[model samples]
Target chain A: MSSSAHGGAPTGQGRAAALDPKREVQRFDLHQRLQHGLMASSFITLVVTGWPLTTHGIGSSQSLVELFGGMEATALIHRVAGVCMAVAAIYHVAYLGYLARARRLRFSMLPGPKDAADLVGNLMYFLGRQKHRPKFPRYTYFEKFDYWAVFWGVAIMVGSGLLRWYPDATTSIFPPFVYEIGLHAHADEALLASLAIFVWHFYNVHLRPQIFPMSWVFITGRMTVEELKEEHGAEYDEMMSELERSRPKTPAPAGVPAEAPPAPEDAGGAKP
Target chain B: MRVLPPTGPGFFPLLGGKPRATLILTTLLLAPFGTGHASGPASAPTTAPTAGKAGPLPDGALAADGFTGSEKIAPPDADPLRDARWCRLCHDDDHFESSAWRTTAHTEQVCRDCHSGYHFNPHLPAELGPEAATTNEGATPAKRRAAAWATCQPCHKDAVPEEGIRHGLPEPGKPAAENPPTCRDCHGDPHEVLLSKSLPPVERRRKMNDRCVACHGDAERMKAAGLDDHVPAAYGHSVHGRKLDLGGERAPGCVDCHGSHETKDLKDPEVGRATCGECHEHATPDFVTLGDHRPFTLEARPVSFFTLKFFGWLTFLTIFALSMHVLLDVYRSVRVIMAANRNDDTPGGHA
Candidate 1:
């Protein structure tokens, strides 16, 4: 396939014209997309099943309870949702480990000095103290924070929930009071995490300016060239530079049969 | 006297006898006084006896002066001198006459030991005027005794001592303010004081449990007692406490597991699940076999306690960190917008 098919948007024009159609390359693959879909669905199910018990009152909770068929039904749904989440988590870990072993994965979304600098620089810019936007790497500080938060939230909720689910077994190896403390911590933390997702994460990714409708990166797994440049200028520049360096040298047009096109074996193997 | 009737000698013999006539007239004249004497001393006064004399009397004599001439009339079946009121009458002296006066905790205390001089009768009707009754008129006698027992504060007022107030039973030398168990509060009847240890097991348990809930059930008191506000509420809803309230025979109570007069502090290692297990055999065994319910100490049950605690803390910390991360994400987005705005304002600043 031509580079245009993978690196740029399609158009009726020839490949040369298609190469500059103002779109960035895909960031997430099929596996990543499937994982994200499962995570989202399972999390939504968990919230629906679990939140009624926490916000127990006479109103909406009663209807929810009935919807689930009763309190026992609600509990059963919660447990089932918990199992689904647990399975999803296990699959995620295995997949991540596989990817890491194969050197196909890199944690590019971790926070570093660049993120801190971005925060301060952006704050100054907001206060009218700066004249330029801060440059960002492959991921902005917020995206890095979001990514890390999901991992942390998943780790906590699954770990605590499992301990609670098998309290008798846990107590066999641990003190009973530990279970009580675990119960309290798990419940309160879940509440905090869920609220934060609803209020802060949702607002940033879906309600902020310019991204008012939604951030299509999560849905489409791709971003436009302008969006990549605006949000991750440094990363875009580095990627462009790398692409230019790796481009194959063009041969003379229709003359001398291109000098045998330099034996196919001598070209740098093949592009990924 | 004429002797002309000598003809009917034998018939007229005693008809003229002076000794027999004299005897009959004398017996007739003394009948009223004799009957009065046979009825015991006709000098005892009868009215509701005053407080000092209303209980069992210690000495057999009139200790007070007011009834000296009123005839000490002991009922045919009862001894007047041994009567509680009779003793109080003569020994009407406040310093020593009152029956409850010589009790250990309230020696020299008058009739108002815990009664507040109102609603002194345990059987008083529930709807009596409030001012004329103790504050807890509608409460059970046991509960009233518990609340009013605090009346010991009038004289022995001070916060109850620490060691004494730590557990179910009052500690020795506990001040009235702190350990104010009135005479009747713990002892039942002011007139029927007995050694706590000597009481029947069942009676002792019931009385002790009754007193505990008096302070425990009170939200304010429980808060002051360093317990969770929800403890009482939880206990009230618990199977044990509920069954007790419903009068279930098998239900455990505060004193059923905890000792009546010698209740120990919950912190005592020896007093943990073992103590609770005394009566709750099932619960205790479950706790021990399952290794639940026992207090975790670093030196004692380290591995078990720490494992659970570690998971708990880890879970909590992770959630907290995630929440913070989400919040920071929001902040970063806001910053991004602000940065974009600034960049737009600057010429040729587009990335």
Candidate 2:
């Protein structure tokens, strides 16, 4: 019944105090969180303006058109939103490069034999095929699958959208039919992505019994210490060991005097 | 009453033979007069001849006999088989030979019915000098032949009743103009009334479009009709019309979409949707939810708002999820790489 059991920590300043001895790990920073929020809102605007023209009748299209301030307004908003998505994608790629050069980037989201085993093992556990809990790494097979799907979705939507936006230019390089094909792919893939999010991603992140309301990690970009231990045990162990190794050899060097006594008593005192 | 009889001889003896002669003469004269009066009172009244009734032949009229009549009769000229008597002597067939006369609204009228002054046969041909005939003729010989149709307007003065405004006849007080659309304008030929039923479906359908375009294609006339002035121009450029002009039979002509005999205006709600759907079979309730005939543009609104709204919301939710996924992936990947680098730098760091 603890917050960490659902993969989140309590809010605000109390969050730090709520961290138990087994909890305490950092995942996303402020810049990444800001980019994510902007990208999400822009993508929403793009879908709102674009999808109505694709699936709905003209009457329905008009309201969406009016929402963006008439047909021209809708198109303009969509283009601007597309630019926003592109900027977000560019920032993500740049951020990855920075992380790689700094030796901070991780490949934990990549699929492996262990993830495959986890999938079968978790299915077995759910079906009452096994009595023991399945061992998991920092990212489960589902989480990895979700992560990879986004990259593929973004690549498809953005690539097709850009081609459609500059159709004449695209046709000059490719055939006119190519632009038409791109348009088709763009719309159909968008529909697929939308459905997948509703059925799969939404259920996993928000509607599941373990996380009935929502997973707040997307909003706050933090996880409790107990959450790190239970869901990302291996990562949690590695982080703690690194923290210990990085600690000063002695209590104080003269001027700095070691910030405060190691608060081992506070650790593991509260359930996050 | 006195009984004379045989004893009248006594009275006769007194008056002598003179009295007997006088009585005989008077009786004879009075008997004739009395009989005439009696018959006049018993005889039936005879009715006068009515208008258009057959009357006795005039004195100058030709008789069946070979005697020379008041008017000089020439020997039967021209082919006897094709003589005026061949057709006209029995029936008033002159009216039938005029352009479109038989096909016209006035088909029931007789020759004398309209041409009161012109007598049939033995009459001189309508006098026309070569110069005068040429001056009166139309732009072409065919048009000149069409002039015969004008004879109908004397009785059928108003030809275009459907046209709200009259244009050919002169103003109320002015003299009549020469521009009236004679029977030939619509009926084409008096002798050959084109029966609509006789035409095949394809020709009948094509004629419908032609009839509409006849007036509609004229920019000035269409403007006068209070219709879309750009119709002719726009239709010419449209894919359907252009294809038809290029000889594509499959292309939809005006009547192919609009009905032929039962053509209704585009504004009629019942016909509008059906007309558009005639070609676009996929025009579902969902497809035309916007109503038919929208201008093509980037800002053109769709027909159904609900479906659009649903997709819009769904798309936004999906993109939001995707962004979060990308963020989490970046975070996870960075952490993994950093952990690996640390392990690589330290001896036995993997343990």
Q: What is the DockQ of each candidate?
A: 0.06, 0.02
Give per-residue lDDT, candidate 2, residue B15: 31
lDDT of 2: 0.47
**Native-contact fraction for each model?**
0.04, 0.01
Q: For residues A13-67, could you state the per-residue lDDT of candidate 2 as single tens digits? A: 3223333443334455655666667667776787787776563334555465556
Per-residue accuracy of model 2 over B278-315 as CA lDDT, tens digit each: 65543333222222223222344222233345445756
* DockQ, computed on Cα atoms, for candidate 2: 0.02
lDDT of 1 by residue, B1-351 (tens): 110111111222333423223333433454454422232222112222222222332222232322233344333333333333322323234433344334433433334344443221111234343332334445444344344435543553343332454332433443333443433454454444445566554455456666666665566655655544444444444334443343334556565555444456555545655765564443332243332222344654465456556755765675575456545545545666666678867433333
Score chain A of each prediction against the true chain A by TM-score and list the results.
Answer: 0.80, 0.77
- Top candidate (lDDT): 1
